[model samples]
Target: MEKQRNVLQVNGLNVAVKSAQGMLPLVQNLQFELKPGKILGLVGESGSGKTITSMALLQLLNQKTMNVEGSIQLHGRELNGLKEKEMRGIRGKDIGFIMQNPMNAFTPVYTIGNQFVETIRIHTKLSKKQAIDLAIASLEKMNLQEPSKIMKMYPFQLSGGMLQRVMIAISMCLRPSVVIADEPTTALDVTTQLQVLRELDRLRTECGTAILLISHDLGVISELADEVAVMQKGRIVEKADVYRLFDHPQHDYTKKLLQARPVLSVNEELSKLVI
Candidate 1:
C-alpha cells in the first residue's frame, strides 16, 4: 500500500486587507497540507485569521479590498489569482465549503429542491428529475427524514441542524475532493454536533474526502482531527499530531488554549471537560 498524496496544500500563504497605513496582514507565512481521508483542524481564537485563510483558499476574498499572497494548490492545481468565473466552477465541484451559519448556505425564497437540483445540474449533466433523486438520496444518507417533503420546503422552514445536514448532503452529493468545514457545528446542540461530526467522519472514511476543520473549540478538534494547527495573531504557531499536541504542547499559546478548555465539577473536584 502507498501513502495517499495531499489533496490540498498551502505554502507561504498570506492574506492582507487594505488600510490607511498600508496592506495589513491578517494571515502570514501559513503552511500546511491535507491528505485524502484526513482531517486537519485549524484551532484559533477570533481575529486569528483562520476564516481568512479558508476564504483565501476558495478564492472568495474581495480582490479590490483584500490581497491574498502565496500558493494555494488543490491537488497540484494552483488556485491563487484564478478568475472569478474559473473559481466558480471549482468552488462546489472540487472544494466544498460548509459555513459557520447554515442559513448563509441557502436562499430563503427558493425551494430546497430547486436549489439542489440546479446546483447538481450545473456541475453534472443529470436531468432535473435525476438530480432531485440524487439530492433525496444524499439527504437520506444524512438521516434526514421525509427527504421528499423537505425538498419542497424553504430554507427558513427547517431547523438549524436540519439545514446544516442539508448543506452537508449537498456537499457530499458532488463528492468534492476536499471539504472546508468552518465552525460547521457551532450553532447546533451537543447531540446535533455529534451527528455532524459523525457525518464528517463518515465522509472521510467512505469517500476519501480531505477536510479542513476550523474551530475555536479544542474539544471539537480533539475529537475529529488527526492533526492540529494552532493559530494566534494571524500565524500558525504550532502544528502537530492531535494526541501529541494535546499531551505535550510545545508552544506557549497551545498550552494556554488547552488550559482554557472548560472544566466540570465532579464530586467537588475540578475535572477537565472531556470531548
Candidate 2:
C-alpha cells in the first residue's frame, strides 16, 4: 500500500514583527509535518515562538505590523498569502484552532448555543435546528453534563474547564483535518487538564483529526504526542518520538528542560494518558 500523505505540512515558516530596531524575528525557519490522527507536540518555554507559528498557520497574524513567510499547507493546499475571505472559508472547515483562553474563542455578548450553531452553519449547510443538535451531541461526546443547559449559558457563566470543552466540541464537530491546540490546558487544574487531553486524544483516535499540541509542559507533551519538536529561541532545536525524546534527548536545551522536571510524575501521568 502507498503511504498516506500528511494532513498538514509547514515548511521554512518565518514570522517577523516591526520594531524600532527593525524587523524582529519571532519564528525562524520553522518546519514540521502532521499526519492524520497524529499529535505533534511543540514544546518550548515562553517567547519560544510556538504561538507565533500557530498564528502564521492560521493566517491570523496582523500583516500591517508583521510578516509571515513560507508554506503552510492543509491537505496540500497552499494557505500563505490567501485573501481573508478565502481564509475564512478554510479556517473552521479545514483547520480548527483551540486557544489557551477559552474566553478568547467565544464572544461575551453571545450565548454559547448561538456561537456554536452559527459556527456550524458558517462552514456547513446545516440548518439552525440541525446545528443545535450537532452541537449538543458534540458536547455530550466530550462528557459534558447538561449540554443543553450549558449552551443556554453565556461565556461568563461557564467554568474554565466547561468552556474549554465546549470550545473543543465546536472545533471537533466539524471534523477539521487538523486542530491547533495552543496551551489548551494551561489554566485548568490537573483533573481538568487530563479531561481536555483525553478529549483531544479521542479526536485523533475516533475522528482521525491531526493535532498540533503546543505547550510548555513536557508531561502533557509526553502524554498526547506521538512525536515531539523542541523549540528554543524561535527555532526547533530537536524533533523526535515522545519516548525517545524523553528518554534520551540530544539537544542541550531538551536535556536541561527534562532535568528541571520530576521524572516520576511525568511517567505516572504518561501511563494514565497512554491507551
Candidate 3:
C-alpha cells in the first residue's frame, strides 16, 4: 500500500520556560507525524510534557516567556516563526483544537450560536444566516437533538457532555486538516466518553482529518490511535504501531504502564483465589 500523506510534522521540538533559576525544559527533542485520516496518540503521565508538546506544535505558547524551538510543519508550511496574525488564520481554519475543558473554550456570556457564528464568519465568508445554518448542521452530525434550541443556550446552561459535543462540532465545522484533542474525554462518564470518542473517530472517517490525541490512558490510545508515542520526563521513550506497542513494549516505562492497568477481574476475584 502507498504511504499516506503527512498533514503535520514536528522535528527537534523543544519547549523551555523562563524561571528564576534559568530556562527549564518542559519538552525535549520531541518529534512525530500525523498523517491524513490517522490518529497519533501521545500518552504519558501528568507533567510528562504531552500537553506542552501539543501546544508547541500549535504555536499557542507565549513566545516571550516560553522558548519553543524546532520545526512544526503543516502541509509542508513552517509554523514556527509565523506572527500572531498569520497564526490566527491557520488556527481554526487549517487546524482545529479541542481543549481539555470545554467550558474554558467558550465565553460563558455568549450564546452557543453566537460564538459559532463568530467563529465561522472569522474563518469563512459566511453571513450570519449562512453560519447559523452551518452550525446547526454540524450539531446534527454529532447526533445532538434540538440543534436550534441548543444553539440559543449559553455554555453554562448545558451539561458537561453536551458542551463537549458542541465543542467537537465547532472544531470540525471548518473541516480542518488536523485536530489537536487534549484529553477530550477527561472528567466524563464512561458512556459519555465513548460517545465523544465515536465522534472523533467519525471525524477521521468523514473528513479525513488527522488527529493528535493527547491522553494518559493507554486504553483510550489503543481504541483510537494507529500509532502511539510514549513520553516520560520531557522525552519520548517509545513509539510504535499500536499493536506492537501493546504486545511488545520496548521501554521499561511502557512496560510499567501496561502492567499498571487495573485488572477488574483480578481485584474482584481476589477473595475467591485466596480461599
lDDT per residue, candidate 3, 1-275, as tens digits?
98777999899998999999999999999889999999999999999998898788889899889999999999999999999999999999999999999999999999999999999999999888999999999999988999999999999998889999999999999999999999999999899999999999999999999999999988899999999999999999999999999999999999999999976787768878886
Q: How many backbone clashes does candidate 1 have?
A: 0
Worst 10 residues of 3 by lDDT: 266-275
Sorted by TM-score, highest first, which candidate order results? 1, 3, 2
Model 2 stretches astray by more than 4 angstroms: 263-275
lDDT of 2 at 173: 93
Which residue pairs collide, candidate 3?
A: none
Q: TM-score of every model?
A: 0.96, 0.95, 0.96
Q: For candidate 2, which ten residues in a row score worst on lDDT?
A: 261-270
lDDT of 1 by residue, 89-141 (tens): 99889999999999999988899998889899999999888999999999999
Cα error, candidate 1, residue 68 (Å): 0.8
